[model samples]
Target: MVALRIRPAIVLFGDSITEQAFGVEGKVGWASLLASDYARRADVLNRGFSGYNTQMALPLLPKVFPPSKDNQEGSGILFCTVFFGANDACLPGERQHVPIEEYAKNLETIIGTIRACFNIFSSAATKDDDKFPIILMTPPPFDPAAWRKCRDLEEDGRANNVAKSYGEKVLELGKSLGCSVLNVWNLLEGATSPEVYGRYLSDGLHLNEEGNRKVHEGLMELIGKDHPSLAPLEAGATGEGLAVEEKLWRELC
Candidate 1:
């Protein structure tokens, strides 16, 4: 029989970037790294929808992340991260183009729905208990010039400046709503040059290994800083087997 191991979980809602958390190469993605690091500490769920914009994601939220009936099954949800906007920022007239204003409203509604389902509206819940912390991660900046080489997108399918504005909106919503914001837009901008930054993405629009690591590091830093209570155990050079051995000896004696 499979052993039952129930632990708090992490719900990651996003687009393709999140879907690739566990890369095809077995263990190269950010989700893979985070899952390994969080082993026995927290369970991570990937709820990514490829080619989906916020408008698409918002409607599906009710079906996928239904109201949390805590203790209905496993350990229950501890945290949730919303990573989207890459596709949503697609230039107008493109298949996935969502107007900038609508995009902002969509994100706000998503957060509100999540809060309602998590029971944040309960009068008895403490600020910490009912208040499920939401992490709003902006989409990573893309290199449209590089993307053009790969294939033809719309007249402005994806551009750095255009993408930055979407991420800026996410940052704005996060601040006003008291949500944790992971600004991949500005974060990846530190790469200095377009070529250097391009290295972070495999297809000019998606994340590569280096990019995954950058994301993982940013997530780790955020978790450690904002939610120390949910941080994973730090690995040391040696295992703690000696302590187990000592416990056995003492019990026998």
Candidate 2:
């Protein structure tokens, strides 16, 4: 359970990208790095499930982000990033494929649910009162060359172009839903070299350090512009608005 002190949470919800955010083997994932950036300001919750598609991800939202009390005010969800599709775009017969059409619908449903959960504070406010926002991230591009060497190409899975299609659809969904987005697929593609694109993917699937850095940069850009409220508090201030314990340890010692 989250401590009452950390009422607001910056939730990083997605598949393996999230799961590996705070890496176990010493290297930190982008989410963990971002969490450090916002340390003391808010709690960053990681909700990544490896190999999960949208169909598998939808059911888990309510359990993690239940509705707040009707009158509760403030940043309950600081923000959430609904990232999926890496697995959903797997080619037919792969363990993770989901039809592209259904993928769009699933995203809509998830965003709607998120709004409802956060809307518990007011049923009468105009659109202006809605300050919170969710971000949607397109999955990173896949590398066929890496896949060919690491796994059987005949087994079925996505290629970089196929990933681009899914990524574009995600951008469209974000626009129609009025949500922000981080198009990592294109960001990576735009910056990577044709000769070294494989370096970005540790296994033609999971991200490597360079890929994670790209995600971190993309996310920081979005949050800095759209949701500055979620940024780390000034030096010593906590999310609540003041720094009650800034000097506590020194005083106690």
Candidate 3:
């Protein structure tokens, strides 16, 4: 029997923001964009759980990515993006609210688990030499004005300031731990006006098509710079003696 070529996985783990990454209704899903970019290059696995916070994500880690000795060559997780904090940034007394301090700890634990997987699965002689390929993403900015139109509530469940606070914590953890970080909050912060901000979101909480496009662009930029080997191959490259070959294809002819 021919041994099949194993494709490494690029895991996208997070909350509803992530779970809805493959958004419908003609909405462009950032996760889906990544999947397209990495087609035949790697598998993008979406492990986003709707309405989950760091606390909830902790318990689900082991089950989602069980340690395996067979994670060699093209197999196993090539990299993972840890993107939580949206739900956790909810106001105090809110259903999904998680304290900022506890949120930090949970993030650390998650990063550690991904590192451990590298050591367990990699053929590397020492863990110290291998830098784990992981990206920690900050939650996107919350637009309270847009949110109010959708929900009939006396009080807002989430606040932009609170979300910024969570984003800051993620940035801090990423710097201290030396992992790649994506500040989605800052990335999408350009929509300063209330009217403009609505364009990026579906219901103030979820991302719309244009918002997802911006995110995909940022992620691709990071990957191209930080994890160049894992970045998607571009089409039309000429080689020795002007021999051209097309490496880009969605499916076989």
Highest TM-score model number:
3
TM-score between candidate 3 and the true structure: 0.86
What is the lDDT, from 0 to 100, of the residue 189 in candidate 2? Answer: 79
Instruction: Please state the error at residue 207 of candidate 3 in Å.
Output: 0.4
Q: Distance from true position, residue 248, model 2, in Å?
A: 8.5
lDDT winner between 1 and 3, please give it.
3
Give the alpha carbon lDDT tens digit for every residue of 1-253 in model 1: 9867656667889999999988856549888888887775677888988889999998898776777564325455667899989998988888998988999999999988877776433332224544667889998878876687777654447777778899989999998887889888777773366787888887788888888889999998997777666666454324321111123344567
Looking at model 1, residue 35 earns an lDDT score of 83
| Cα-based lDDT for every prediction | 0.77, 0.75, 0.79
Worst 10 residues of 1 by lDDT: 237-246
- The model with the greater TM-score, 1 or 2, is 1
**Deviation from native of the Cα of residue 50 in model 1, angstroms:** 0.5
Candidate 3 lDDT score relative to the true structure: 0.79
The clash count for each model shown is 0, 0, 0
Ranked by lDDT from best down, the candidates are 3, 1, 2
Q: Report model 2's TM-score to 2 decimal places.
A: 0.83
User: So what's the TM-score on candidate 1?
Assistant: 0.84
